[model samples]
Target: MDTYHKFAAFADLDVERFKHFQEEREALSTLKAVEIDTDADTRLTALTADVKAFKTANDNDIKQLKQQINASTKTYQRLSPFYEQRIALLDQSEAVIVQDDDLYDEITRTKTTQLNADRLDDWRNRTMVLHHQLNKAHEQAKLKEEAERAREKALIRRRVALQQRRQQASLKRQRINETKAYRDRFDNLVVRVRNRVDTLDFKVIDAPIEVINAAEAVAAQAFIFTTLKHTDSFTTLQKSLRDTDAKKIATQVQKAATSLWQQLERLPDNQDKVEVLTKINERFDHVPAITIDGATLTQTVTEHLQKTKNAIQAHEQAQTRRYSSPRPF
Candidate 1:
């Protein structure tokens, strides 16, 4: 009985004050029409700031209502099982209620307010949520400070990168021009060298000595008929002439040197006393050409250049082997 009486007193909390506030709100609404003796200039201004602030707070409160609703929904779901129990319990408690006086009035008022509070809780939560959204909009509207800071940083980076790109482009242009000039000069030198080689000329002359010349013509005729089957013929030719080591040379080179020596050895001059001009012309040609190709190409240039380089290397290697004999022959 004491616990029931305490709950009744709690349920009526702020009832008198809440009533006073409600009555004042009604009076304020009717004041203009009733022509109350209120000063025109001294009229109250609208509470914009207070209303907005309160609305924001209310919206936040309402937005959080889903959790409470979910809880209540769960309770309502479970309420069925407990419904008969609750009704039975309330009946038993109502009998106990008749055993008190002041407790009855307080209990009735408490029940009335408690029911209303329970019903309006969801609405309050919704109001709080709307209030918070309004506050967020207000914050977003006042973004001048952040925008200014971002603009400053962005401009600084833009200028730095622009200057860097300009310098890089200028350096690239300079390098390209320098390379073109170097290539132009090299091309000019090659053209002059080619012109000189194209003008070079040579003529075949009778072997510089009479005896060597006559004997060479006869041996040349003999070589035309020779089948190259003579194994000792090669050895005999090497022994009869100025060549000390003919066997070590390439086949073509050995044949050419042997042919030249065979003609010279059969000359009418002293075979033992070797002459100077006869030895010098052996395995040698006087007129040499500048051997660089002068052809031009657009896209097919690389392959042509590779083939030309390979050919030049082979030609030089042949010259090295032909002239580099360890003997005077």
Candidate 2:
């Protein structure tokens, strides 16, 4: 009867152990059924730590239960049936734990894959944005380079144009200087001719033949120098000088001829006067026959001298007749 009571107590203890194991298994299933937020990394990491701790604790509990069952089997050989039943329960519990472990591993693998895919997508998006920025920078740099080249070209063109303008201005100044020099030289020549013309001494009428010839040469030169040819190209100043010189020369010739004619008229009515008049008439041939007021200067002087000679000859003949005839006194 004591042995029977001891077996019954052992059975009751086995039943309690089995009930505790069942409770542990049901707790494990409950833990698995609770859904974890996959998007939250902190929650998933905490849940995985908790699952690992629970698995370690369950493994310890299972090992302890097995040790107790072995002790009980050694002490109570008569409780073989109970020991066998507990062994089967332990096996079943082990199987369930293994299945839960496999399911947790699969969940871990799926979460890892999802996290890796999210990381790859993020990397690709960043790469695309970086590439776009690089392209934009490259295009902007190209445009800037082109603008710099165009500015350089425009500056070079402006410099060339400025140089050309300077060269043209220099040429124009040189031409103006040359033209001014030519005009100065031409004016000097005209002034020299005028000075030579002014040197003529037309006041001296009874001068020597050499002096008369010198005067006549001077007059001829003045006439030729002052005359304007049709082929001559003259400026306004040169044309004015020529006309003035010509008028002056004509006036001088007229004055000299008139002075000689007046000198002949003042002479006494004698052969000396007639000889002087003939000498004067001969001198007149060498004078320039310049015309003034439609009358030639030398020709008019000759006519006046001829009239004086004729009067002188008539007076001399009257004096000779008076000397040959009886004295009228």
Worst 10 residues of 2 by lDDT: 104-113
Q: Global CA lDDT of candidate 2, please?
A: 0.55
Q: Judged by lDDT against the true structure, how good is candidate 1?
A: 0.42
- Global lDDT scores for all candidate models: 0.42, 0.55
Residue 95, model 1: lDDT of: 48
Candidate 1: misplaced stretches above 4 Å? 1-145, 196-329
TM-score quality measure for candidate 2: 0.32
**Number of clashes recorded per candidate:** 12, 0
Candidate 1 on 198-286: residue-level lDDT in tens?
Answer: 33211233344543433233222222212122223332323332132223222333344345445444433332223322333231222
Candidate 2: list runs displaced more than 4 Å.
Answer: 1-233, 269-287, 327-329
